[model samples]
Target: MSRTAPAPAGEAAPPRPRRRIPGLGALRESGRLFALAGTTVREAFRRPFQTRELIEQFWFVAAVTILPAALVSIPFGAVIALQVGSLAQQLGAQSFTGGASVLAVIQQASPLIVALLIAGAGGSAICADLGSRTIREELEAMEVMGVSPVQRLVVPRVLACMLVAVLLNGLVSVVGTLGGYFFNVMLQHGTPGAYLSSFSALAQLPDLYISEIKAVVFGFIAGVVAAYRGLNPRGGPKGVGDVVNQSVVITFLLLFVVNVVLTAIYLQLVPQKGA
Candidate 1:
């Protein structure tokens, strides 16, 4: 047997070598989120799917986000019309105003607006629902019963967000284009025939395809972030509130970054053609 000498009475043991790594905590959290996303994806493809839950979530998300999408899109269209029409008149290209407005809305505004609404409205709802379940020990109960909350709850919500986001993008595009048409022709005295005629002149099929893709990606990110925060909430009701706020902020930040990257790539791959 070996005898070891104890430390001096007043001396403290040397602090265990502090393991310091820049952004270690953030990296850990990010890894955990990615793992959670993987689990959700895996669950999504498994058998005995949650059809009713998916439908319910789809309806819920659509109901919560549709009105806001419409309201924002109409004004977005009007603003584009106002600005584009003013500039086009100066350049003697006023007939291009409708095309420009439609292109702008479909290419950029609708996807971003739909994403924001989903993050603010549907994402928050998911956080609240999951947080409530967490606080009530429902998640633990499911685990005890060998049931996965991820499969039951997260997958449905995520799929619903993605589906509704694409639908909402289409809705926003139509509403925004119509709003721009009304403002340009009625208010700005733009020729109706020119507005209608030039609408498809500058717009391309790729723009619509890319916009829908962006919507799907944004919705998936928002849903995942919301689910992760909600599932891992700490403290109590206040924690749930904090999680909701954080989810929205993170979703917004990620959406903007993704938008920039995707836009850059799209512009590189498919250079815009002149009308």
Candidate 2:
């Protein structure tokens, strides 16, 4: 006997196409983050304590960026000083240009700029590598075999970033100060002690403290964002390339936006009325 035919088009059918669920990917990603983060933390502490992975990751992230950050800071500082000096001169206040220069670099520019560089170069590299592995199912293979990819893959990078970015930012701040110091002290005939004094004067404890805070936060964000983007590529696997590029873009934009908001918050809390 012939089976009853299914309902015709435009009529009720045995079953409608399953409704496309919203955020299938997102829900999956959320679970992945939890799984990834949990495994990362566990492996982070599971070692004999202070293992080779931690050391290697620390070197990888921090060492690679040190030279670039140092090189960039010099020009960055010089440009800042020249621009601020020109503006001050026009306003008949050239005497205070050093103060302005130091303030510009340390207050927000130095650390924030450092964050951008590492986030673009170092962070994006991590994304590309991991994304490639993820798309090829290398991560899946690790999972199926009882290996934790997140622990081996994610934790080292994240830990590296927090350490490296801070160190890089510190280098940025120091080298930048030297550029301003040399320009003000050597070429312009300003006293070395006076230059140091001026720079030091501009950096109150609160300013330096806030700078450290910014470094850690931005570094952590860059690391986590890169890892997240990389581990969750799209297009069924061919999207790895785009994932790396997008990670860089997102890291940069997010860092810049966060920098602005942090600066505003600091200004409000610091109370400029007295000074």
Candidate 3:
């Protein structure tokens, strides 16, 4: 064992060593993130809302995400339709192909696809922009000028993400449904009347409500994750790219977990139409 060195005659004794707590850093980071999310939500409804910034960010997010989301939905819908149609046919339930395929797309694939695109495209952009500003000390400058960076900057971006995600969810559902319908009719030899009728019979308003709710929740999650990472980047300018990537990955993981939870909750709370 090693002994401590003696202090100077008139000097105070050295301080005792503090124990390190495992995962304390991680826990603190998580707490900070949740606090920031709460602050953003509360501030979002406050007056003097940044209307112009909100509009601009909304347009930017939509612009970057719309075309790619549309293109991806086409193939995603077609694949879901083809698979479900084939399976239904094997089970001698081909008449329900439309209901199965449409429900699969709307209830599952559509929100996921929208969320993926939002996090990948729009979220990455948000992270990059905020991270860049942070590295450049712009956020600090704003603070020096008596502006709350989270309020003036983060709120608009997060709100924009939510709005864009909601609108894009609707677009994706419509486009994907059409794509599924087209593929099922053409490739699977599905009857148009039966497909339409089955969908109408099986689908309920709550289905749409759940989808939109998921979109909203997913959007909020993505925006918050991106903002949190951006606002707390490491290694300065060069690390912004790394922060963006981390935000995307984190958002994706969180989205899937949240999706599962939301889907489970929805199923538990909402009764089936024919059940």
Q: On a 0 to 100 scale, what is the lDDT of residue 201 in model 1? A: 77
User: How well does candidate 3 score on lDDT at residue 105?
Assistant: 87
Query: Candidates ranked by lDDT, best first?
Result: 1, 3, 2
lDDT of 2 by residue, 137-167 (tens): 8998999998667677777787888778777
When sorted by TM-score, best at the front, the candidate numbers are 3, 1, 2
Q: Which stretches of candidate 3 lie over 4 Å from their true place?
A: 1-19
Give the best candidate by TM-score: 3
lDDT to native, each model: 0.93, 0.76, 0.93
Give per-model TM-scores: 0.92, 0.79, 0.94
Question: How would you encode candidate 3's per-residue C-alpha lDDT over 158-193 as one tens digit per residue?
Answer: 999999889999999999999999999999889999
For all the candidates, what are their Cα RMSDs to the real structure? 4.2, 5.2, 1.8
Per-candidate clashes, comma-separated: 0, 0, 0
Total clashes, candidate 1?
Answer: 0
Clash count for candidate 2 is 0
